[model samples]
Target: MKEEMINIQDPILQLKDVSISYSPGKNAVKNIYADIAKNKITAIMGPSGCGKSTLLRAINRMHELYPDIKIMGEILLDGKNILKMNPMEVRRMAGMVFQRPNPFPTMSIFDNVIAGYKLNGISLSKSEKEEIVERCLTNVGLWNEVKDSLYKKGTFLSGGQQQRLCIARALALKPDVLLMDEPTSALDPIATNRIEELLLDLKQEFTIVIVTHNMSQAARISDYSMFMYLGELVEYDTTQTMFTNPKDKRTNEYLSGQFG
Candidate 1:
């Protein structure tokens, strides 16, 4: 049977000839063009140094924080050029979670969740802050476990809990897109499973773009998959199709363990 094609109208974000370079004459990500569907989980997969994470960071302009990095082409979020928007606003709309759980050590559990607002100088009333804390924590499945100790330091929680706290922090902004860079790579099996479950549920509300090295994790959670190699995107298709029958030789080899 022939596979159904992805419709152009379904995309929430589109990358057009996107490329990134960390230094002169060296492109980390080269000429990537793809559409990310709304409210679906999209995984970017490749071996280390293949530019999966670089492309993920460029989605929200995270590379701008560094002086040496430069990006080319347009990354449109809902048809608006994200690079032209204010960096902070862009980040708020497309929040990120890193490889490690990086809850602020100096802040309490409650503060960590609302840190984005505070850092941005957005003042909230006591009641408003409380509402956000509860809502975001609950969103990440951490409210029940941490509610009693909301005032404790963020570092007080276990590794999994800290990761959840970081996720809660991002969710508090109510982002349109959530970008995760190997979010569960540092986690243990149980913790990773929990995060995977959380991501599955999250796709119902937000468009999720994740960079993952774990092939099985991508196969299990992503609705669409992009396979990159040596700074180039080799294939982008439905996860089932990409895994079962990739059109590109590189993608097939990578999936078959012949090369990465």
Candidate 2:
């Protein structure tokens, strides 16, 4: 298993000339091309409605949520096209955490984290599931806060804690890739810093692709950055390079606030 993992490709995910359209004539993403680095943070930054969220959703096949939307082009994970896999299997392979802290309002904190396993039909012994809950919560730095109140409703927690619970839920699936769409956008500065710190630690175990409108967050957390404009990727480079000296004028303009 170690040998096979080592021999694998550098990109955990590859988007080859992909284009996405919601309807017959409405193209949300056009001629998009990019790769997500393995075990590192790849930041996707662009103006709102420039297909930023749409492009991130495509990685885990979340575009399938919209029946009217259609995707063309290959999205490869470990050199295999994701389109060939079942939507459920693909989602399990790449877990997603949304922009909001959306822990189930009715479920307990313990139930929320391991909900993925129960919902996905993956079986584990009672103690094993308990362990998964503890481990995942600890991994996301929420264990200490909620350890004693694991049985309490998820929504009873603060907004930041709810978001972290959602993260723990995704992590429970043991996904190879974790996609975060503006995970910190709604949180306070302290909460945002904690999430950023956790993300830096998470990439040690799994690939991370993040979409953030915050340029400072992107510069601080990402190993690499890809800039998209008008539904096209304009620059893909090391985070340092992209933030310091971008190759594309559009990227530079966007970064400098000349235009979005």
Index of the highest-TM-score prediction: 1
TM-score of 2: 0.95
TM-score of 1: 0.96
Ten residues in sequence with the least summed lDDT for candidate 2: 1-10
User: Model 2's lDDT to the true fold?
Assistant: 0.87
Q: Can you list the residue pairs that collide in candidate 2? A: none
Model 1 local distance difference test score: 0.91
Write one digit per residue (lDDT tens) for candidate 2, span 152-257.
Answer: 9999998788989999999999998999999999999999999999999999998999999898999999998888887777788889999898888899999998
Give one digit per residue, the lDDT tens place, for model 1 in 192-237.
9999999998888899999998999999999999999999888889
Model 2 residue 248 distance off true place after TM-score fit, in angstroms: 0.8
